[model samples]
Target: MKTKAVRMYGTDDLRLEEFELPQIKEDEILVKIMSDSICMSTYKLVKQGKKHKRAPQNMDTNPVIVGHECSGLIVEVGNKWKDHFRPGQKFSLQPALNYMGKLDSPGYSYEFCGGACTYCIMPNEVMELGCLLDYTGESFFEASLGEPMSCIIGGFHANYHTNKRNYDHAMGTKTDGNILIMGGCGPMGLGAVSYGLQFENKPKRIVVTDISDERIARAKEVISEETALERGIQLLYVNTAKMKDPISELMAITGGHGYDDVFVYVPVKEVAEMGDKLLAFDGCMNFFAGPSDSQFQAEINLYNCHYTSTHIMGTTGGNTDDLVEANQLSAKGAIEAAVMVTHIGGIDSIAEATKNLPSIPGGKKLTYTQFDMPLTAIGDFEELGKTDPLFQKLSESCKAHKGLWNGEAEKILFHHFGINPKEL
Candidate 1:
């Protein structure tokens, strides 16, 4: 099948192109893309092409249909694929194709299936190890966040190791401990916020520290305001660049005792070192993001490390199991995965959407322009018996407004959103 997709040909350059792909094999299925939550990694691919070792390398150029974080409807199924996938189930795309690399996977590494495209062939590995799932009425956009959700779920599932302790401690399941995430306003960091404060068992406090006040304010919009107050999700805004000692600033926020668990999302050298200094006894340090060339070193005083019983650990992409847990959480409404995505655009608007990705005012960035309904309108999914007209209008209006986004906020009524005010 030939589908319209965002084709990446080089660094900082992308375009809407038509690509030819084989039809589903007996073991495959065809998916109609519903929603794509903009992945930071996908943005990274655009900024730094080819260098991403796992990115598809085109000898002709550096073009690849670059998107992994997505959810879609199963349109067609192969003879062998029917047992697992129905004709129209909402499912997240498990795009990271290489797991142990036993054989070729359609959407993990080089030939990864893209969520950015309108349609794709769901490979065999995707069906067998399908982390992607959707309830009856849920929008693809809501389910699309599953990829990011899976990664966080994976990191949380990892048994964090520390030389200070005799045994490996699980980072994600802690309840009584103090959870502090540095640079917690970003997408990966915010996911930690949702997982810690909303989904995880009763956390003592989900404290997020970031340099930007704007980002902190935006973060508050996604997570519950009342629940955060009730559950003690204190948002800490600090200017690390101005602080003589960021550790001291963080220390003050934790009432000078330091953190019980620190999830470090920012990869800046000094920020990491600062995180190491503020670890309390038997505390776990989770380095969530990776450094550019592996030269990024986090320093800690040896005596303090040994005496303080501090453990430092890092994790990358999660295994398939985490994806499964994420789906359940989404289905149950614990994480509110779908609502976190604030904007929805389409393939032609890829460039515009990416420009806003780095500075998204709220939680998740999404691409749902190609779809038929608003994510919210798809609720009560069990009866996938009928379509909603309101959703159709919203989706179509989103596409129309997307075409008119010229950086200047012009007044245009989105017929679908029913927001017909003269003001945009």
Candidate 2:
């Protein structure tokens, strides 16, 4: 079968090309991709290409597809796996497969499998590890968002605090405690906030800090302050760039007690250091951002680590369990995955969209594999509606959902784009 994908040949080298897909073996599966959400880590991979650890070493000889966060329909299931999986089932993937202690993952190591492609083949290992999960979500975008949401959930699980005796330590964020999310208006940060608020061990207060007021405003709109209030949670948004002393302002918000849990979303040394300084007694700081450079370092106070039990830690992609939790929460409406999306486009625009992801001033950029359209920000739907009737319908759908992308908007877009679910 013929398929199209955005392949990465080298650093800053991405191409949209057509190729033939090999027939699926008895142990393999074929999927037709629907929705894919762009991640910052993917941007880093685009810039690093062959130098990336998970990236194939001989990209000049064998280029690889570029995307990890995606969802699709099972077009053809292997005969050997007929009992476990079937055609027409919707599914999402957990791409962090630590197979044989090797860093082989989809979108980085796999040539035939990646989220950016119209169709991809799932190898035996992916099925053996249970990395592919059946999704019952309302929209493909929700399933695509499961991967990024799992990363945030993993960060929360990695956090822990030790007692004075050091005999016992509590794992995970403190319940009913002060929590601060640095750079909390970005795509990943917004997911962290939604998880933090809706998590079973809910916090007493959540303080979200960002440099852009526009982003902060969008965060509030997505995860409504009224919802937080109804849940007895105090939600505060602040632009640290406008503050004389950002740390002091954050400290004052906690009434000088500092934050019990600090999540640093920016990978810069300065932001990590700032997160460390804001830690309260027995506070745990989770460096949620992944840096591109290996030698990246952040300074921390040793005295605080020893005397106050304030420590910092970091985690990479999540495991299979985290992926399942993310999928379940999103499917149940316990968490809103749509809030992370701020832009939408089609597969044809992925090449240019990825090259300029850092410059794009919004949250996650979603791409539809079957559609051929220019990249459009969600905020500009109304403006674009002036000329296009489809965009006009999309704008009305999104506005009805309070400016956030949801399943309703997805259905509208799919119908207008001529994607018949029954046919798929």
* Alpha-carbon lDDT, every model: 0.61, 0.89
Runs in model 2 with CA error above 4 Å?
Answer: none
Q: Which ten residues in a row have the lowest lDDT in candidate 1?
A: 404-413
Pairs in steric clash, model 2 = none
Clashing residue pair totals per candidate (backbone < 3 A):
12, 0
TM-score winner: 2
Give residue 416's lDDT in candidate 2 (0 to 100): 84
